[model samples]
Target: MDLQQMRYVVAVAETRNFTRAAERCFVVQSSLSHRIAGLERELGVRLFARSSRRVDLTDAGAAFLVGARECLAAADRAVADAAAATGVVRGRLAVGVIVTTAAVDVPELLQRYRARHPDVHVVLRPGHSAELAAAIRNGDLDIAFLGLPESERPSGVESVVLDHDKHVLVVQAEHRLAGASQVALREITEETFVDFAHGSPGRAQSDEAFAAAGLVREVAYEAGAGELMTRLIARGLGVALLPSAFIRPLAADNPELALVPVVDGPRRIEWLAWSRFNPSPATRAMLDVLGVVRHA
Candidate 1:
């Protein structure tokens, strides 16, 4: 009924011993017993069974325990909500970052965030766009970097377009297309390709660009990691259509790989996402550090 009564009942249910529960509740044993009796009288149910050696919940008490826990949790959440409303950003912030960006700048951003907000606990989870999107929608991730599907952004998500990454072609230097100054999308359609696995945002973008150009490139290898895909390409398995950034350093050092710009390719939109209904100050602070402004 009252907060104090709920507290007393929950304590007794937890300890199953009147004396121990009283100690835990910081009340006298007799006071704890009186409070539980008062609660049982109000509810019109026998809430507990007591004997010389043990204390146990009655059938009704077991059912009431569930509601008691829920009420306590609600009270705790109310207190937490009040604390967060004052802009005191100190709590757990879970982020879901895509695999490719995780290897690039997300770590740097998270490092800077931790340095700035030492009191905040950061949990970084790496996932692809679809998984990240689902995590945000399911309340598993506080924020995520997602690649929204074209013509179909999922409902009830707050997201901002971070950037548009251009797609580029990666091939071994000794390949026939390498000798050419710049190869067209149609020109490389016949060449073998190292592609992203199905359901990936990159794979979808690659398909979109190739379809636009009316070209269907042959996929010789399909893999998860970019480094692994590049390695496969290096072995002369096939070429790959990847973000321009991933291929930059490899092109500079490795004489075997040529990072050529895709003259015709669809652009991939990078998005930063959070739930529409669950906005926490900690997540807002992290988003600010990452230079993302929230959009509906």
Candidate 2:
């Protein structure tokens, strides 16, 4: 019935818990619950299926949430547009970044953006590319830096390529393949692998490359961070396919690690993505500062 109520609905839907949603919205749990109940009654439909453990949206709730998100986005854009008209860019910009990418100069970009729009508040969340893509699609993030295949980007989002880096095979210095300049996927198929979790973008790309070569790798260990993966490799755990940019600097300090190019591996394309819908003025300003122009 109101923007505040819509925000409450969206926050609850995103967090999936009344207590956490209230915390996110800076309201008391009882007040959030009461308002949501009033909203459900006013709409003549339940927005959420309550439970002791977790909250789930019913079919009706899911249907209503789509419009709720659009409405909230519109409201935000209206305010941002008004501020822009006044020659001021002011609002919260929620940004998501892939955890293992070295291609993006996030710190420098943030510094410049902050200097240009001192009034705008920027919040950064780090996650795997898939998780960041999901957050951007859910309206939880205004923009994100993601590692995606050039041809298979997420739907409902517009993206610009920020940079490209190739995946390389990392091994301990004494490993048999360490002396090789470039190794084929099949050559390393039988070697124990250390890689990102199964669903992560990096892991998915590596898996697809091997699958394309008619080879399957046994993942002996999984790590979420490139540093941990390097540490694992240095400890002689197994070989891994990681971004060359990520491994190069670390390899400089660790003499025992080797970085060999994967002959036909996937290239990691880093993209800055935002909703193709009406993006907020803050989002647009940052994108402009980053030298990306969104097409209509």
Candidate 3:
């Protein structure tokens, strides 16, 4: 019925123990029980099945938990909105970005963003672009940096191109072709290639580059993350193609891995994506500072 009640229900559902939930909610166990009892009485259904040893949600409770959490989240957003209404942008802004971007001075950008908007708290969640897109759509992320295909922009979302990221081939220094100034994509089609996993942002770009070159690469290994790709290449597993930014740190530290430029690889365009609907002021400030907003 109220935010406190909704918070209590959510905590109980998450912890599944009245005492634990009470501790999490920062209230006494009996108070938590009383609140649940009141919520159940008001809703005309028991929200939880309780015993001395454990607790479980009723079918009705399971359904109510979803709505209760939504209500709590909405209330929290309302509070944030009220705080931002004072003409000072102050609230939590959740940002999602690909791990690859972390390698390329994103922390510097965040530092500049925070310096300008000191009151806004920016929470960075690093994942693949696909996962970041889903999080943005689900309201879990306020904004995200993704390698979104220009043709597949989601409905009700807005995007702006951030940078053109070049994809390059990585090989062990001892490889025969490592000394090449620039290797054409066709040259590596016959060579064993360390490929990024299917459905990853970088993988899509890699595939596009290979397809554009009309080259069919034999995947000698597939890696989940860029770091894994670098590590595998360092161990002489095979060669991989990734953004040039990804190899900068590794190239500096390791003398054995050569990051060769891909002569015909497709360039990945990075985009800053956000919902087009009403955005929080904190979110707006972040986009403006990031130069993601275009002038009309």
Candidate 4:
């Protein structure tokens, strides 16, 4: 019935543990439990099914949470709006980014944003391109930086194209084509490859390139992370096609690694995406800062 109770419920739902939720809300476990018990009674719904080992939201709790999050968001927006009227921006800004974001200096942008709006709380997380795009559209993230193929863009979100980049083939120095200035896709189709997970946006660029060229590749290792893929390429586990910016520095430090331009390699586009629907004040402020950074 109260905002505090809603906060308690939301916290418990997220952490799925009363004690952890209390810790997050800076309250005692007993007090949080009593409040949630009172809230469930007032609402006439069983919000959570409890056990000694685990807690899960009931069906009614799932439905209630949908409205609860909206109410909390609206309330936070009202507070942020009041602050904005006085030339202060105060709220949380959650930013998601691809693991290999090459366009736009994120740290510098965050630095400028923090200097401009000292009251805002900023959080950054890394995810794959499609995952970051989904977070932007779902209102879980205020904004995100993503790299997808030039032929594609995140759907249902407002986005700006930051830059386009070509991929290069990475091979160990002992590899056959490591000394080559450049190589075509067909030339490397028979070579064992290290690639991102199948169907991932990072993998798609190279996958589509081969498919378009009517070639098939042999992938011997599938790395879930960019650094792992780079290490595999350096170890002679297999060669990989990666964005030039991301691979250049790694190849520089490891003399055993060679970056050969893929003359017919796939290109990727970096995008800055945000929610198209009612975005929060903090989100809008971040977008404004991004506009300045983009032009600067």
Q: TM-scores, in order shown?
A: 0.69, 0.77, 0.88, 0.94
Order the candidates by TM-score, highest first: 4, 3, 2, 1
Candidate number that wins on lDDT, 1 or 4: 4
Worst 10 residues of 3 by lDDT: 148-157
TM-score winner between 1 and 3, please give it. Answer: 3
Give the whole-model CA lDDT for all candidates, comma-separated. Answer: 0.77, 0.86, 0.79, 0.88
Across residues 73-177, which tens digit of lDDT does each residue of candidate 4 receive? 889889998998888899999999787787877899999999999999999988888888888887888899988987898898888888889999989888889
lDDT of 1 at 218: 75
Candidate 1 local lDDT, 163-278, one digit each (tens) = 66676788888887776666678878888888777777768878877877777777767787788887887889899888775567666787888877767765667777888875
Colliding residue pairs in candidate 4: none
Q: Residue 147 lDDT in model 3?
A: 69
lDDT of 2 at 249: 83
Question: TM-score winner among the candidates?
Answer: 4
Residue-wise C-alpha lDDT for candidate 2, range 1-296, written one tens digit per residue? 89889899989999999999999999999999999999999999999998889899999999999999889877877887899999999888999987666776789999999899998989999888878877888788989988875446766787887778888899999998889979888788899999888877878878888777788789999988888888899999899988777678889999999989887986778878897767888999998898886677
Poorest stretch of ten by lDDT in candidate 2: 148-157
Q: Rank by lDDT, descending?
A: 4, 2, 3, 1
Model 2 clash tally, residue pairs: 0
User: Least lDDT summed over 10 consecutive residues: which range in candidate 1?
Assistant: 147-156
| Residues 127-235, model 3: lDDT tens digits | 8788887788778888887764333444446777666667778899899888889988888887777866777766777777778667787887877677777778889
